[model samples]
Target: MKQEVNELIDPSKFRDRIDIKGIEKSLLVDMLRKMVLIRKAEEKLSEHVESGKIKCPCHLGIGQEAIGVAVSLVMRKSDRAFGAHRSHSHFLALNENTYSLFAEVLGKYDGCSHGMGGSMHIVDNDNGFKGSVPIVGATIPIATGAGLAAKMDKAGDISISYFGDGACEEGVLHESLNMASIMNLPVLYVCENNLFASHLHIDLRQPSNSTSRFAKAHHINYNTVDGNDVVGMYKLLKSEVESMRSSNTPYYLEAFTYRWKGHVGHRDDIDVGVKRGAQLDSWKKRDPIKRLADSLIYEGVLTESEYQYLNHEIQNKINSDWEKAELASFPENEFLITQVYS
Candidate 1:
């Protein structure tokens, strides 16, 4: 099973999968744009984290952008989404305002969470991004409850919870799955299986390489997907998300990916953990942005020069947003107390 998982994650297996047949150009371009923006925003966060500017720990999902893009594309504004520690991609995929994200990371007054919730805690209710927390499994049950609320409202809205492979070990996750399954709630549990829970590889933690087994145990419909394949993810999610929304049943998608950087910071953290240097390089080959862009170029949807120009434009936007956000004032000392709950 472990070997099968390895084969599934192998970059070589999906390298030639660049076809965009039958996919709308608008959706494909949007997916590529979001993926590129998320990667660049995370790179900005990484630089700040390494330079002592960002005090809070940042979990970069450099290689996990596709899951966020594909899942978010299928989501509606009425639906709610929650993300775990490594959720910059998820948040940005919904709300492209990187300025607010930068402010939140810097603890400024105009941040998404009013400056208190650093890189980990972010929120945008208008965009259906309910929140993201650093706590591993805290958002699982909350998302499930949101699903229940949506069901009661009869609005056909769904709840999405994005958690890592490590969160699978938490009891709350299983409980939430069981409850959602029995209640037939409209929830989609997205597990971003990045192959590592902190410094420990998943092989050392779980009997099976995939986390979808738990979904099967809970009798919830599930599928494990190639997280790097944005086109494939979009195709799969269109049906699954639509089915769950209409049927009011829970669904699970465990995205198999690899985080380009370490668990909590910018560095690769490859020194101690079994040599991931080669593996990391291979994963880069399957980079969502590159593959999608290459496919678009190959299919004549975009030229190489056009793709480069689009990247340049996004880079400039990110730089402008970050610069302005960093200059914003931090909140007053009493601000925290006022927002604090009893």
Candidate 2:
């Protein structure tokens, strides 16, 4: 069974899949647009980093955009979502404010965090993105707390906690799962299992590739899907989130995905003594953005020209936002004293 699961997650086997059925045309296009926006925006960040224009470290989720876009379909502004270091997709999918993200990473006052938090510390309370921290497994308990609050309020809102495979190793994650399960907290734990935690592969760290076993141990309702499949992810999350909202139950979704760039920069982490050139190439072939577009085209929901036009539009928007962020002023030195806490 483990061997079969491994085969199912193998990127090479799923590269040619462009299946879309019983899905709305508008949703397909919208998801495709968001995925493209995320990809192009992250690519631009790579360019800025390579040119030394940005000093802050950015963990780009270039290939994991589909997970955020899909999950955002079922989430409301009242529901809270938290993410980890590779969370650009998470914020954009919720707020659609690439300009603010750009400004924040550039340390401009026009940023989402008022130039205080960098890429890893994105917080948009109005958009229901409570926050994203860099520490592994840090947001698990925080999201559980949010779930508790939601339960207390008796509101049909849930909390989402996005983390990576590495976070599964943290003791807090397990504790958070057990607590949420026992309390029947309305929380959705989405683990983006990219098979690598920093430089090490999952084979070296965990006994099995899938992280759902932890969820099973906690007796939480869980489902594992291809993070690259936006439509599939949307279907699964939408159902589970709705169920959780009604029943105040916890849901665990383990998404199998891969990061295109390095663990922490524009370039592939190859220079840091990791050699995944072939694997990266294989994953690129399974590009989630391309897969969705192909599916839409194949299903007669979108034309090639329409898709190109959409890409052009999203790229232009990203360019304009990036330019604005570049021209934005840095926060004043005096403001730092006011923002500091004793």
Candidate 3:
């Protein structure tokens, strides 16, 4: 049965499924725009890194844009969201400020964290993205606390914690889940199970590939969905958010996704002793952005020309922003001492 389950959750076997009849045209277009924006922004960052312009470490989520967009669509600007290392998509999907993100990644003072935090330590409180910490499982408890604060206020606002399958191994995640379940806090755990924890595959790390089973252990309501399907993710998250809002209870969603790039660089890192190149190629065929555009075009909701136009516009914007970041000034030396304590 474990073998069967592993076979079923295989990333390469996932397919793109979008039902145009069940979605709105405008929302579909917006989702496509956001996904494309994220993909292009990451691609721009990849070029900067290859040219030695970006010194900071970057964990690009090249193929995992849909999950962030779906969840962001269900969240309000006041609701809090958090992310892990591979979280540029999470920040952009909610904030939609590529300039600030590019500045942040480039270590400029105008960055979201004012150049102190690089790609991993991103913060935009006004946008409700509390922040993203690089330390795995570090933000789980923080998000849980935010949910508790929301509960105390008796407000409908909730907190979303986005972590990878690797973070699931951390003891704090289980503790946070159990506490959230027992407290009935309005927290949502989005596990982007990309089947890889940095270099090792999920099969080598865990007994089972499914992370939602842990939710069962804590008796938390859970749902597993194909992370590549933006529409499906949006619908599922919408319903879950609604239930959490009404009942003020925690929910868990396990999104099966695959990162196109390697763990922490621009290259695919195929030579890193992992024979996942072919599998990565297979996952590209399940590209979420293209799938949505094709479905919309097939249903007369969007035109081929319009799709091309959107891509062109987004690419130009990302290029412009990258150039701006490239020319931006770094933080002043003395300012670094302000945020530190001895």
How much lDDT does each candidate structure score? 0.89, 0.88, 0.88
**Ranking according to TM-score, highest score first:** 1, 2, 3
Task: Report the error of model 2 at residue 244, Å.
Answer: 0.2
Clashes of 2: 0
Q: Across residues 11-56, which tens digit of lDDT does each residue of candidate 1 receive?
A: 6677664668899898888888899899999999999999989989
Model 3, residue 24: distance off in Å is: 1.8
Residue runs of model 3 more than 4 Å from their true location after superposition: 1-8, 11-17, 273-275
List model 2 lDDT by residue over 197-219, tens digit each.
Answer: 88888888888889999999899
Clashes of 3: 0
lDDT of 3 by residue, 24-118 (tens): 77888889899999999999999888988888999999989999999999999889998989999999998679999999988998889988898
Question: For every model shown, what is its TM-score relative to the native structure?
Answer: 0.97, 0.96, 0.96
For candidate 2, the TM-score is 0.96
